[model samples]
Target: MAAHNHIPLPIGQVPSSPYYIHPSDMNSMQFVSNKFKDEGFTDWKRSMTISLSTKNKLGFVTGIINKPNLQYASYKQWERCNDMIISWIMYNLDAMIARSVLYFNIAAEIWKDLEDRYDSIDAFFTKMKMLWDELHLQSYSKDFQTTTRSEANAVLDEAQ
Candidate 1:
């Protein structure tokens, strides 16, 4: 009989603490403007997700609300998180955009509406092709080599 050596799988590293996004930071955060659909949508989405996660309110953005049968304490916590997420989103949005989503009571509903509006597969591919063309056009310009390294990297990161 041969003896086998057992190896343990590595555990995932835990975050030291929940992320915190200051209210002041939220106030100053760039609004998702009209150009967001064509140019900045992915970056805006990534930043918003990170901000929500850091505030420990990502559950409200991503998760469903508790059932009516849930305990009072659970329901209260959900409500608080939902309110915080809604406030944070409203604070960071353009006035026009804010008006559109202001009536959403569920954080997940707001999140889904934004995703459905901006993150459809066709939109993603169109954005990618536009970015590729822009990069190609810039490649022929004099400063492209020096100027676009960071911008190109950001575009690539968002595409993935």
Candidate 2:
């Protein structure tokens, strides 16, 4: 098996071919097993195609990471991106687990509330995504006062 394209998935009892496995789970398993230390990274990139159901497109906003040049990157470089995704997930997962243990009562903990109230991780992610996109553009537009003004305007407009 090609090292970069066929990292084993951590799904169930049976090990199937590369197609049926989830690239994300394969990435998590790569963390514990040194066998995945150098495993090819093709399995880690699960977002090349639209997920149809989630409708969430995956893109890296911060620094230069993998740019989806699937035809160009080497297995080693793929490994680096895999590491990056693992780190990002770890940070988010840490927040998620901490929020669960904290009983979901904190007002400053939106992610925790999302995780606790949502049915699945994907559902929580979709909600978080909406919050992130709407945040700076609308939620915090002018200041705290903008929220009240906007809401009052909307309500008044609705009544008219």
The list of candidate 2 runs beyond 4 A from truth reads 1-73, 95-160
Candidate 1 Cα misplacement greater than 4 A, ranges: 1-39, 64-71, 121-128, 131-160
Candidate 1 residues 1-160, lDDT tens each? 9999977432211132222333453433443443233345567777887766665556667763432345653455456546666776776666777678899988788878877776775577777888899888988998687876687788777986
Model 2 C-alpha lDDT per residue in residues 12-120, reported as the tens digit of each score: 2223321122345433322221121112222212322122113121222222333335575243344443444434333333354433434422222322343344335
Cα-lDDT of candidate 2? 0.35
Total colliding residue pairs, candidate 2: 2
Give the lDDT of residue 105 in candidate 2.
23
Residue 90, model 2: lDDT of 39
Clash pairs for candidate 2 = 3-40, 4-40
Which run of 10 residues does model 2 get worst, by summed lDDT? 32-41
Highest lDDT: give the candidate number.
Answer: 1
How high is the CA lDDT of each candidate model? 0.63, 0.35
For model 1 the local lDDT of residue 146 reads 82
